[model samples]
Structure formats: C-alpha cells, structure tokens
Target: MNVTFRCPPELEQVLPRPVPAKVGLPDWLRRMPATAHDEVLGVELMTVKKCAPFLDAMGYGFLMPLACDLQIDKGRLSWDWDLPATPGETYSRSPVALHAAAQVRGSPFEKGAAPMLKFNAFWTIELPAGWSLLCTHPVNRTDLPFRSLTGMVDSDRYTDNFINFVAEWIDPSFSGILPRGTPVAQCIPVRRESFDYRFEVMTQDETDAFRDTRDSMDGTAGVYRRDMRVRK
Candidate 1:
C-alpha cells in the first residue's frame, strides 16, 4: 500500500535532504534518524496486509477504535482498492484503502455488533513546525510489504496516550492475535538539511500479516462480501 501526503507549502520549503533517489526501507531510513519521531501529526496511505501485523506487534492494536475516530475526524479521501467480484481480482488491487471494519468481524465487541473501527477516510492535517511527521512504505509485490503510520505529536504525552491506549485497552481486547515483542523496527526523524525534502518515518517488519489474514478467509463462505445499505 502507498501512503501519500500533501506537504504544506510553507513547511515544504524546509524539507531535509532527499534520500538518494532510491526506493526501499533502508534507503529511506538511512536518510533520517529514527529519533525524529516528534515532527509528525497525520498520515495518508493505502492500507496493506503487512501493516496490520506490524501494528499488532508494536502494541498499537488500540488504534483500531481510533480508526473509526479518524474516519469521522479526517473524513474519507477519494481512492480505489481495485478489488473485483472474485478473490483473484481482490489481490490484484494495489495500494487499497482498507477500512477498519474489514479488520474486525461482527460487532467490535459484541457478537453481532457493527465494527467500531472505521478508517475509510484519507488523512489531512496542519500542525506547528517540527510538530508532526508523515511517512509511507510503498509495497513491492515481490518483497515483503512495507507500510507506515505517522506520529503526530511533539511531546511524549501524545506518544504516551497512544501507548496507553494500546497497552491498557487495545491489547487486552485483542490479546489472542497480538504477537510478543515490540512491533516497530524503529522510530525515525524527518529532517531538512537541503532543498530536497523527505517526510516519512516508517515502522517495518518481514511478515505478511495482512495478506495472511485475507488468505485465511479464503474458501470461507461469506467472508469477503461487500456491504449493502438500504435507504429509507
């Protein structure tokens, strides 16, 4: 999946040196220090399968609830998942916008309740200079999928709130799925040393967690159906 962001013009002028015009996580990470976790506020990207597991590993499962909040807060962005009527077509879609509802089944908590997480919207944001950072880990079909979630705060308070949300609430609720150990490979910084700029701090992993989830649903009757709404 690809996460795209429109950098504010004012802030865009002060971007850090671009990482050697190459594509890949190492090149991207080497360009910026993992310590630059402070200058990010919001992110916009296509959701990928690998990201789900990475988030779970990082103890970020709590954001599942916030996924719904972001939808209401950020609103939806125009895009397409390119999923077709069949499973083969579904995998063909690249950089798809994944909704929070797709991740959880039935009610978020109850047996028949609707999903509490809803992330259909693309993200948009405005923050103080050096206050927020956005990143994207474009997926390579042959390589392990690389995805990202931007950090949007200057203080630990925001990070702490996120951590607490994951640890105290999300973790307990989804304990069965979360893997042991920290999920994130590292938290990097965004810098502006030259005219060229880069804005992304990525957290990466090797497993195809998202793909695995979707694959697991394969052959399971009534698993990948699209939703239908009845208007009054």
Candidate 2:
C-alpha cells in the first residue's frame, strides 16, 4: 500500500523523515546473543533474539521520529529550535507539548503520571481509502524513557493536519538529551475490515491437529519458522 508523508515547507529539510521500523531497530536487539545458558535447564537455549515472531513485531511498520533534540533536566523539558514560523498563521513550533494530568485520571498512568508528553508531529500522513493508521509505542521497545499511548486515526480521511502522539513519561528523573531521529511513535497502516465472531469446542480432528503442532514445537526448534511462518 502506498502512503504519503508530508510536512511543512519549513520543516521539510529540518526534520528527519520517517523510515521503516526495521531500519531503526534498537541497539540492544542488534547486540543480544542468539543463545544463552539457561540456569534451570543447565544448557544453552535460544533467546528471544532467535524468535521470529518477536523480531517480526519489532520490525513491523514505520517509525515517526523526534523532530529535534530535547533536553530533559530534573524533569524540565527544553529545546533550542530556531526555525522560522509561517507568517499570518499560528501553530506550535515546538517539537513537544504537555497534556494536563487530569486527562489521564482513572487510568493506570494517572497515579504517578507526570504531565503526559505530547510529541508534536510535523509530518501529516495520508493513506489509501479504507485504511487507518495505528499509532503505538514502539513494539518491544521498553528501553525508551516514555511509553507512547496507543491510538488509531483514519488517515485516509483526515490527511489535512498532523496527528500528534501522546505518551506516559516513564522517568521524571531521567536527565539527558532525547536526540533527534529517536522514534517517538510506531505507525502501521491497517486496512478496515469487519469480522464475524464464533466460538466452538475443539473437534477430534482439531484436537489431533493441535497436539501434533504442539508436539512438533516441543520436540524441535524453529518448527513454526520453518513450517508455518510466511516469509516476508
């Protein structure tokens, strides 16, 4: 599916372009060992680094990056952006904003939530008809200092403006620079569809099939990768 990403003329050259998530994989994933010694089993076993599904999820879709480096010192956020603003118009020129703490009340993040960080996106995304964009925290990326709240937008219909990402700050005490090009959001284009729901007990054939699959998985490594997974 073809998708278009556009930004303000002033930001076209200033901001980093969005890229596939596979290209921005965290360094830990690249450095992790494929196999590790399991103390319980007293043998070397494959780690998640060798798991196809886990890797696939990590690399799926595209990443929206931070527009500029942000300085966080003792829970205060600041930036050094000096881009020229458009004449005769008013809009946020900053790369980030904050939502009131009350907005997240009653949610798990509410208890200790600092002002929720809002990544002010400069780019506007447009997807094909019948498609929406799923914006979520970078999958399996617990290393980030914040967790992006999940949301879906009908990008196909709302392509006129930017869709900012809201996130729960993980560490108010984290004092450092969140550099430009760091992924603030992971976006996946999802085709709209309806589903019919059904629930049923396993039949004899289904039971046998399930057992066979389970036994194969228990007996060998990469059974799903070798026999079931569709190659990307």
Candidate 3:
C-alpha cells in the first residue's frame, strides 16, 4: 500500500499522474453503458450486467501516460518527441525508437508483424517487499495507435532503472500528434505467491454455493459489493 513513484526533476514537472482506469474513459463511453444500446446480437454492451466487465476492466488499474508529445511523420517514420517539462532540452535520439519487424526475434510476434517502437520512460516505481508490477497496455484500449507488449517486473528488488513501453505500431498511416499525457501503460501490483499445477473439480458444496451465488446475483446486482469483494 506504500508504493511510491519516483521521477527525475524534469520528468516530475510533466509526468501525468498515474490514475484509475475510470478516469481515462471519454465522456461518451462513460455514459454509453446507461444511455445506449443494451444488447448486440443477444450479447450486451450498454446496460446488461455483463457490461460491468468492460467497466470493471476500464476501472481496475492505474494508467501511466506518455510524458511528452510525440509527433510522427509516416512518410519517413520519423518523429519529434518533445516535452515542455524541460524546455531547451535536446532530444539527441527520438523518443520513439522504431525497430523493424524483421530485426526482432525470440518472441511470439511473427516476422513482419509490424514495425515496433518503444516509448522511453522517465518514471520508476518502488513497491514494498513480496510484490511485483505488471506493466502492459491499458486494458480495453485497443483504439490506440500502438499495442504495447506485456512485461512483469520485480520492482521491489530491481531498483536501478525505469521501465519503458515497448509497442508495435499498429496503424502505419497514422501521423500527427500523440499528445502528451497519453496513457501508454497500465501497472498493477501483484503479490508474490506460490502456485501448483494440479487440477481439481468443484465439490458438491462449491457447486451448490456457485449456483446460489449466481442466482442471487442474477436476481440482483452488487453481489460482490455486498458480500464478496474486499475493499483496498
């Protein structure tokens, strides 16, 4: 609970505060769940309880935003990554480092998948013991121009450096401003725990309890709010 974010003086001035995913929602989307379509081909998006999943995903973790403005010109795949935090600071290297898809190996991404670009990071986090940080693209944020790769860091132990965002540029023709404070990654603290691979089925008591819980939740919402979820 005592996790802390540390930044260089230059970065501290411009770094967007890490915020709950709910704050990232555009006004239109935040209202869609109540004001629009209720079902799509029998599946729901607007008002059904299932839509809560989307809301939940969009409200669960903290989003880390880009510290500066990144302007890209598709014609040459070049950029001017600039920040107001440190005026007159020279960007010797483009903040967006474009790596040819063909040059990368040892990952699930296929050859020629897309040109990969990495966002240089200026923030580092210090979490307490027995914890790790899961860094990846913001959940349900596929609308962005890039797809950031997932990474897990033992922030409690690795304190020497910052973590950057590694993403595959998804839209090749996109140009112009990727404005400052754009959420680039989501970080969630995960406690280190033991795991076993053996499988098992639910007992009769569990099956009955599951049905009871499902029926209760179906009849009324807030099952988790009322009886299950523990507040942080």
lDDT of every predicted structure (CA atoms)? 0.27, 0.91, 0.71
lDDT-superior candidate, 2 or 3: 2
Ranking by lDDT: 2, 3, 1
Candidate 2, position 207, lDDT: 100
lDDT digits (tens) for residues 86-203 of candidate 1: 3332121222243344344543333233223212212222233444333222222112111233333342123322211111012222212211111222222343235877886433
**Top candidate, metric lDDT:** 2
User: What residue pairs clash in candidate 3, if any at all?
Assistant: none
Could you list the CA RMSD of all candidates, in the order they appear? 24.7, 1.5, 3.9
Candidate that would win on TM-score: 2
Please give, for residues 1-232, the per-residue lDDT of candidate 2 as tens digits. Answer: 8989988887777889999999999999999999999999999999999899998888889999998999999988999988977886556988999988899998887855567889999888999999999999999988999999999999999999999999988876799999999999999999999999999999999999999999999999999999988765
In model 2, what are the clashing residue pairs, if there are any? none
Residue-level lDDT of model 3, residues 107-193, one tens digit each, is 765445666777776667889999999998888777788888889999998865777788877777888888777888888889999
How far residue 59's Cα lies from its native spot in candidate 2, in Å, is 0.9
Q: Quote each prediction's TM-score.
A: 0.19, 0.95, 0.77
Runs of candidate 3 exceeding 4 Å displacement? 35-50, 75-94, 100-103, 106-108, 111-114, 221-226
